[model samples]
Target chain A: MIKSVAIQGVKGSFHHIVSQQFFDENVNLIECLTFDRVVEALITKECDAAIMALENSIAGSIIPNYALIDNYNLHVVGEHYLDIQHNLMALPGQTIIDIKEVYSHPMALLQCKEFFKNHPHIKLVEDKDTAEVADRIHKNKLKGVGAIASVLAANIFNLDVLAHSIQTIKHNETRFAIVKRTNSEVAKEAINKASVKFEANHKRGSLAAILNVMSDCKLSLTKIQSLPIIDTPWKYAFFVDVTFETYADFDKAKSLIKIMAEGFKVLGEYKNAKL
Target chain B: MIKSVAIQGVKGSFHHIVSQQFFDENVNLIECLTFDRVVEALITKECDAAIMALENSIAGSIIPNYALIDNYNLHVVGEHYLDIQHNLMALPGQTIIDIKEVYSHPMALLQCKEFFKNHPHIKLVEDKDTAEVADRIHKNKLKGVGAIASVLAANIFNLDVLAHSIQTIKHNETRFAIVKRTNSEVAKEAINKASVKFEANHKRGSLAAILNVMSDCKLSLTKIQSLPIIDTPWKYAFFVDVTFETYADFDKAKSLIKIMAEGFKVLGEYKNAKL
Candidate 1:
């Protein structure tokens, strides 16, 4: 069992909240300022696992996380989707009408573009973290500044939630994965999901050939995304996650894909999370 | 002859530099604040053509432009790659050592993360346009704030270039495409190039089958990128640009690809730009 998890940002950050949902509440928490540092800590064994949010339903995929996952060779042990409820938080006794400025991460600001558009007079300030914005407002006693953050941030920072779920998209949820240094053991009880990253030759149809091998193996693909190979212009390597009924032809599938692909690496195998 | 081209942002922006390279310096300039406005100007016949930077060599693909190209129905008439040279600009006598704040577009700031890391004391500010940062500094006569912008911005704003080519990567060339409302008549006279966007069924081997059609047709693909369909999670549609030595089997290639793929749209047949 994982005893500790390191996440980027402060206590009230979405990563912190998501980490709590996956691990024991008393688990040791290592806070880092950046996502890269959290991944580094896990790779260096400073933490048992690292939890990072990869995508928001409203904001789309966090593309940088895709690169980090591929670069660090970390295995995604499990994933959970947290329904994101963005709240406008301010120091205690402050009201929404009192806000002269609103602060949050740039992406959070963008996600709340509709709110800003409606309240055009409020100056939108970009900060490093959403929870940090609330913490600053509370610590600095900024009467005119509010933060767009989670309800948990408001509670932790002793701020009042002025508005709830102000995000333009009502179904906003962020998908986070728990990444560990080692891959999970393949279970014999039931078929599990697997993820792999592969590079295809620059030639046309290279990616298609790999997909054909999966089809031939009777695997059901869940998700596939392409991230540019940084060194190569106009070339991309694909990351794919697939589900299998059993581990019966898994090795054969892997070999066939290797024959069709220029390079491939199995990221991890885990029981598919229940939505 | 093409008389004028529309582009996004103010003069000294990367788009402006690319447009100047594609069209002569004497061409009329139509500046818009956003990419969508540039496309609208071309589609509405307000401009003869428009140039938009679609990707930076280091920043991967500009995913938003891909969606705009597909939705706007503009024909890509030419392509150009411009080497990006970012400069730290400030009022005439300001030096990098004296700077307390730096401002640029978020993307530009991200490209220079290493530089920012070294100058940790400098507060980084995000602005809508890099050139605008120069303009603001010039107008405000701010002593300690600097802007990361083009050399043209420094010249136009009468600011000094404190540092040159501060990007993380040395060869930071940005790829741009010229789009027009009408197809180029010179397309057939020059080397044939084809652009297509397609969606594959959410099944394994679907994308490969479509690519096989292109390989079978002997077309060389120049660029391929996947943009999230946005409305769906973990689903993407791909856009591909292919070059052909001759137009002999182009129609057959399209038909074969269309049969194998879902929602295929041929953007246009255009001659590759000499630059």
Candidate 2:
């Protein structure tokens, strides 16, 4: 039923790429420049759902996005792990020597900075979006400037890739969350992963006791992030991800965690993406 | 001999404010526009130390800074907590009604978004630095534009305060870490807080058991963040912060954690900033 999905970039950004591969290829894209807007589109009923980058292999968790999900009362219905491949591209017939400056997102530049070190002549310029830079290069016929982006971006902008997979780390991957207003309609049997939020008591060994509860339920803890409760100084709300092979085991853990921890809320129940 | 310190912005950044308060006010600053350069300045001995924002009460951990500290082998020698106060400033005699747009760093703008919502006529624009925007408005004598920055910025840029503490959260605070090339020079008895990094074996309840060990030793866990090991997919390097009333208790817990965990490394042992 997802006819249109909100993405935080243009046609060929990583969010767009994930949307294309995970959902129907022909699904409409509601392009937004910021993650806030992507959430806005979902709340305003402009899109059926949204795809958000949750974390990166090298950079770690996108903590604010987790905050937004909790604040907006959105549900993470599923997830996808995308192997990030950044390529240097420019207008057709341009060589690496001809490039005077390279434009890309700050993170992309950080990932591929070692490659640029070899070519000292090329200046690195931080840009907002990689695909937007490539599109501008092709649209304005700008010469001597290159952009580090995905291969899909090169194709969408009709540019030529000067280098393939130029990122410094070859195994870089990013996790994306598919979010919607309501919980996913998938069958209960398909659910193996669940993300929950809770607060540990002020007493000593509170978090340890909660972790022991998860362990006793035979739940595998995948991710855990602590978010500050702004109203209460020095207190935190823990966001956790756990996977299990059986629904009964997960249900038992959920019930026990709710009793052991304060402010417990199950954010999502979805099938394991890697599986 | 902390004579020189590196900061990520010009005169009135949050980093600069914390630096001035933590170190000597006259400490020469090696200003770097990016954290990467800040790390570089430390590695090259361009500065004696650096003040980096580790986490904000509302925004949670600055994950990449954690990665940079781990990867570059920098040691956190000290810590400070700053109460963030966002002030709206403009040219002299400009009233709130006279302003048409407010500019600040994206996080600052987001923090103060609720304050601007009542006045829809005034647009909110995202800029690189809060103090830099205030300086620009004062330098160019630009009217009808306001910038959300610190009181120090208003004094430095000669701007009038239109409003004080415009951030939505009244009790917002950010924690900064004073870092250097080698470990801190403080006396061992003065240290109560410590940050350690470790990876658990591929066994069930491994992390839970580690947390239990710390609890048994009377150490209070303040924060824990997971960083992905690039070579091993799904494996994480946990960065943990703990505080203890007695050094003997901490040593007991540290020794046990080293035996129970893999790739264990103590990043720093310093006095608790909040205390």
Candidate 3:
């Protein structure tokens, strides 16, 4: 059983919420300042597991996370999707109209670009984290400054929610993965999913060829993303996630992909989601 | 003859170098703070044309550029590749050993993660811009702080170069495109290269079918990238650049591709350096 988890944010951060969702309620939590530190803590055995957001429906994939996941060789044990609820937060006694400047992460600012455009009088400032931005706004007592953050941030910092679901898109969910130091036995509560990385020949139809192979093998591909192959200029390797009916025939599909691809690796075969 | 060009960044930025290479040195230059501003300047008649970085040799595509180009009907007029030189800089009298913290844009920091790992004593801070970080270090007169920026930044900010070419890869280069608000007649300097973006049907082998059409037409594909169609989750649209032997059959090939693809647009036919 997991006893503790280390995440990279304050108590009201989205990461913290995702971490709690992945681990037991009784588990102790350690908060780090950066995502890299969260990975470091898990690799150094300071934490049992770490929950990292891999992609958002509004912003697409978190590209850096893909590179980190590949470099760290961490095993993704499970996954969860959080419906992101962005709110306009301000110190008590302040209203939305009073906001002269808004601060949040670049992604948050981007997700709420429409709001900023509608309120052209407000300046958008990018910060490290949304929750951290709320804390800073509250602690500094900055007048006429607002933060686009989660409602949890308002609750934790004792601020007022000026607006709710300010994102232009309603389907604002972020996909998170629970990563462990090593592969563990599939927990009964976990769903079955497989993560894969593969490189294709520089030929024109390489990607299409691989997708055909997946279709032929009857693998239901859930996601596919391409990252530049840093070692080779103008070449790319793809990362994919697939769901199978069962763990059965996993090796067969893996072998078939390997035979068809120039290079391929199973990042991890694990239970998907219990949430 | 082109009189002036607008680009993103300060005078010594890589984009500046690319613009100079694409246009004559005598051309008047307009500087913009952001990529969108560069495009807006062209669209609003503040500048005749804009030169923007589209992809980095080491960093892959600058994904947002694709959307910007698609959203605005800009025509690619030319392309150039510039070799990037990343440097570690610090205030005068501060050496690498004396630095306890390093600041840079997130991409630069990620590119130099290995160097940070080797020197675990230093803390990595993410800033908005590399040049901006260098400027901050100079203005603040801070000690024990360094920045990862371009050598041009070190020179501009009067900072000393603590380390040179610190990126993990040596052949780091960025590809930039010259775009105009309105299409121009094909010039003598125009080469046999073209870029296109298309969306295929969400069915098995749809992308393969498009690639097959390109191959059958004997078009040599230079690069292909897929960006998520945000409106339609789980679906992707592909952007491809191809080179042909002559302009004689270019239109025919493009028309065939359009017929095969569910959605397609010819970005431009331009002369570009052959990789």
Candidate 4:
């Protein structure tokens, strides 16, 4: 059982919420300000596991996070999908008209940018964290300042949510991966999905031929992302997420792909969190 | 010939530099603050062509731009690759030690994040545009403020260069697409690369079969990005760039893939800009 977790942000942040829901609420949290620091904490055994956002339905994959996970050789233990909700909050009893400036994470600002188009009077400022901004507003009693964060942030900081779910897309869902230094501890019977990375040979049709192996083994490709191998400009490493009905099929495909593709590595094998 | 071109920033941004280099220096520039506005100016005929950055070597694909091009039915006339260099500039007389804050476009700040690690005393702030901040510092005579922008921006704004090529990665490159409402204007003899979007059937290995067809036609896949089809939960639309030795090979593969893949559309057909 996991006891301590490393998250990129403090309490009331999305990563914190994931840690609470994925593990027990009483779990100890080692808060980090950046993804690199989170990885460092995990590598040094400061925490037993780390929670990292892998992909979002609307924003797509967080490519750098994928690089971090791969470069650090971390393993995915499980996954969680969270419906992201951005709320406009401020000191209680103040209206939107009273707000002169808003501060939050740069990404949260980007998501709720459309709502701000109508209110040209308010200036948007990017801060380090979403919930941290909320905490600052409440502690300092900043009246004219607003924040784009989550409902949990507003509740914890005693700020009134002036607007709810202000993100442009209604169905904004982010997939988070629970990672550790060790390989997955999930049981084979419960494993329905796996994330793998592979580099195809320079020969033509090599990538397609490898995909054929997965299909013949009854693995369903859910996601495929190609990241260029930095040193070798044109060549690419393919990161793919596949789902299977049976573990036996996945095992066969894994063995075949390892032999077929260059630099083949299993990033993770865990339960599919989608359904 | 191209007359007015729409770009996403002021005269000294990377996009602005691309506009001048891709077109002539005498071409007209319609400046917009956001990518959405850049698309609006293009769709509304405010400009003849718009330059959009498709992918960065370090950051991977800018996924939303692909969606915008596909949704607006824009045609890719050509592609350009730019070597990005970020410089730190400040008002005349102020040194790096004197600078208290650095303001720039979020992307510029992100790219040069590693350089600022040693200067923990300096605060990094995100702004609307990189060159605009240089202009602001120049006009307002902000003594202790620094700007992270291009060399063109520093020259245009008459700011002293405090540091050169401060981005974490030295060989960073970004690929740009020259898009217009009509089809590609290049001659067939010069065309060696094409960008195509397709959705495969929900059957197993449908995507692999499509790839097999491309390889059979001598088309070498260069870049492939999969964006989730919003309405369909697990389905994805693949955006791929392929290059060939001859245009006839690309044409044959295009026809075959069009017949095999669902929603197959050519986003752009132009000369490969890799070289």
Candidate 5:
């Protein structure tokens, strides 16, 4: 049973929300500033598990986090999809007119760029984290500062929301993975999705052959990303996420892929959280 | 005859370097702070063409830039690969001991993270661009500030290089694409590569079938990236780069893919720079 979880930001972050939704509300929170630190805490047994964002619908894959998880040999035990809504917030008495400068994560600021054009007086500064900025504004009582973060951050940090859903795209979602140091303990019958990494041979239709095996085994490819192997200049390792109706289908496909592809490794076997 | 080229940063950025190496050194440079503005400058005829970094050897693809190019209907005429070297630069006569803060682009700061770990006293701040930070430090005569940028930036800003190749990875490379409002004017026989976007059908073997088509046509797949179609939640538009021995093979593959796939569009056709 997991009692403590590590996340890549302070309280009121998207990772914090994932921890609450995936685990019990009373679970202990271990805050980490960077994804590297999150993995470190898990590996060092400072936390039972770690939640990391894998991809965003708008921005695509967080490739570095994928590298961190693959390099650290972390397991994706579960997954959660969070709807990202950026809100501009400040101290209770402050309004958009009163705010002089806004500080938040660079990605958040980019997403909310259209909203800021109307308020040309507000200067945007990039910070490390979104919720951290909101927390700072509340604790420091910074008068003319605002933060772009989730609504939960405003509630948690006691800041008033000056604007809601200020992101340019209203349908932004991020996929987060619950990772552990060990392989998932999910029962076979309950497992419907799997993440795997493999390198195809340098020949024509090599990747297609592997995909054919998955299709023949009745597995649906949900996501596929290719990352260049660091030591090898031109070689690539393909990271794939597939869902199936039965665990036996995935099991058979995995057996065939291990034989067909080089450097075959199972990153995770988990329930399909998207469904 | 590309005269003026727009880039995402000042004259010393990787994109700027690409512009000089790919085009004539006498070409005019129109620097923009954002990729959106880079496209804007090209679309509005402020520059004859623009240079954009497509991917890095260390980091994966710059996904958002792909969106920008596709959305704006920009054409990629050529590509170049630059060996990236991040240097620590400060005002002349200043040593590393005197530097209290280091400013650079977030990506540059992240890449050179291992080097900064040894110097715990130096605070790392995220800025808009690496060359811009170097220019600021020099113009302001900031004594205790350092910027992690290219050696060319240090030279252009009249700053001293405190350290060379400070990035953790020594073999860093970035691929930049020269984009313009019109397609490549290179003769058909000279074109060896093409980038296309297509959406596979919602079936088990649809993607494999498309890859089979490319294989049968003798087109070797160089790169493949999938970005979600924002309106359609789970569906993805695959951005693929393929190199072939002859233009006839790519032409054959293009005709077949147009019939087999949905929303098939050619993004670029040019010589493969990696070769």
Candidate 6:
């Protein structure tokens, strides 16, 4: 299928990279400047689907993205994990010695802090987007300014890599979710994973009871996040992701959770991406 | 004893208002520009203690603050829920019609969207700080500019409130946690609540088993947040907030949870703030 995938940030961004790596090369790309806009594009049916970076292995969960999914009633159709490589890039002629200031998202800068520590002369400035900085450096011919982004960004913007994999941790990765508007969820024969959300009172054992159902059904609990319910004070809505070996096991778990939990909603049911 | 409290943002910010309402008025206020700085002040003993907004009723959990408390090994001594009222204020004489731009934090702007919908002429702009915008408007004597901040801000900045409690939700509240360096958690005889974090395997139903232990101990689970363990990609550390009627019940639950959960650590044990 020729899918039109919406992603936050411009071309050569991590979302863009994920689109290329996860989907067919012939797919049309719709670039969004904000995660909210990406959600808007999907909800309004402006794009077939959207890719959202849920959490960086190093930086932690993008909480707002979770809220966006829940608020917009989006369905998580699939998931992908991409290894993050933050490369220091600038104009073709620029080198480590030539650059005076470095610009990237605060998180990208934070990941590459140890590298920057060795070179104290280069001032670090936090910007909104990593690829945006790379694009700016390329377009504005901004010399003495470096951007920390992906190698793909360097290739796309026609910039030279002053340093490769400059992030402090080499094993940094980000989990991206392929989400479609809730109305567009198509059922498939082979499904082994599900994401569900529920709200409950602060009973002594209610949450534990819900999890026990998942256990009995042989579902592997991968992730659970608690989001405070906006209107209800001191109450929370829990988002849980579970994986199972068989479709029967997942269906049993889903039905059990739905019966046991309040305001239960299944976000998505698809094949486990990690496999 | 005289107390020194650290709060994020300038004077008259929401955090400052929380500090005043939550603590003794004699506290020496240490104003911090960022939550990181507030955490630093608590960790380094620059202040006797600190107040950090953990979550909002509308916008949801301040997940990063949970990371800060866990990473810094800080102790949560108390908590306070502040009813947030976002006010639109400008130069004393200028009315709503005269104002051109309304600036506040993105969340504040969002909360007041219904009010802004009525006043289509006012352009909503995202700013770094709410009180800071009020401070700027006052400092510069800017007539056409307005800020969405607290009543305290309007008073501190010498501005007139054009609209009061303009948030879409009338009962908006933010939960703030009182944290101190680990040294301050002296034995309290009447402890009723505790915040603990535990790391565990992703085995099917393993987390449920741990929760069962808590249920058996009669501890009421108020909140549970799963934060990504940065160094270990898929593994998560769950931060659970539980309240109990008796310290004995909590101690029993804590001990059992320790045996079942990996890397278990008590973040704090304190008197239940809600009670």
> Given the true complex, what DockQ would model 2 score?
0.50
The numbered model that scores best in DockQ is 4
Q: Model 3, range B94-139, lDDT digits (tens) per residue?
A: 8778999998877788788887888888999877667777888888
B160-243: candidate 2 lDDT, tens digit per residue = 998999988898788889999999899989999999999964345788999999999988878877766777756778888888
Off by over 4 Å in 2: A97-103, A114-127, A136-145, B88-148, B157-159, B166-171
Which numbered prediction scores highest in lDDT against the true structure?
4
Q: List clashing residue pairs in candidate 4.
A: none
CAPRI quality of model 5: medium
Candidate with better lDDT, 3 vs 5: 5
- Candidate 2, after superposition: displacement of residue B66 in Å? 1.4
Q: Residue A222 in model 6: shift from native, Å?
A: 1.1
Task: Return the number of clashes found in candidate 3.
Answer: 2
DockQ of each: 0.41, 0.50, 0.25, 0.63, 0.60, 0.53
Interface RMSD of 5: 1.6
Candidate 5's TM-score reads 0.97
Clashing pairs for model 6 are none
Candidate 2 lDDT over residue span A74-151, tens digit each: 999999999999999999999999999999887798899899999999999877887889889989999999999889
In candidate 2 chain A, what residue range of length 10 has the lowest lDDT sum?
A227-236
Q: iRMSD per model?
A: 3.6, 1.9, 3.6, 1.6, 1.6, 2.3
TM-score on alpha carbons, each prediction: 0.88, 0.89, 0.80, 0.95, 0.97, 0.89
**B132-216, model 6: which lDDT tens digit per residue?**
9999999899989999999999999999999999997798778888898853354657678888899877788788888988999
Candidate 5 runs further than 4 Å off: none
Q: What is residue B242's positional error in candidate 6, in angstroms?
A: 0.6
lDDT of 1 by residue, A1-275 (tens): 77889998888988889888877899888988888899888988999999888765444456677678877888887787788778888988887778899989987887787877877778988888889988888888889899999888888889999888988777776778888988764465554677788886556666666777788887766666665565575466777777776777666789888877766888777777743
**A1-275 in candidate 6: lDDT tens per residue?**
53799999888899999999878987889989888899988888889889999876555667778878877888888888899999999999878999999998777887898999999999998677899998999889999999999888999999999889988779877889899875334455567788888987787898889889889989888888776676665676898889888888877777777787889988777767775
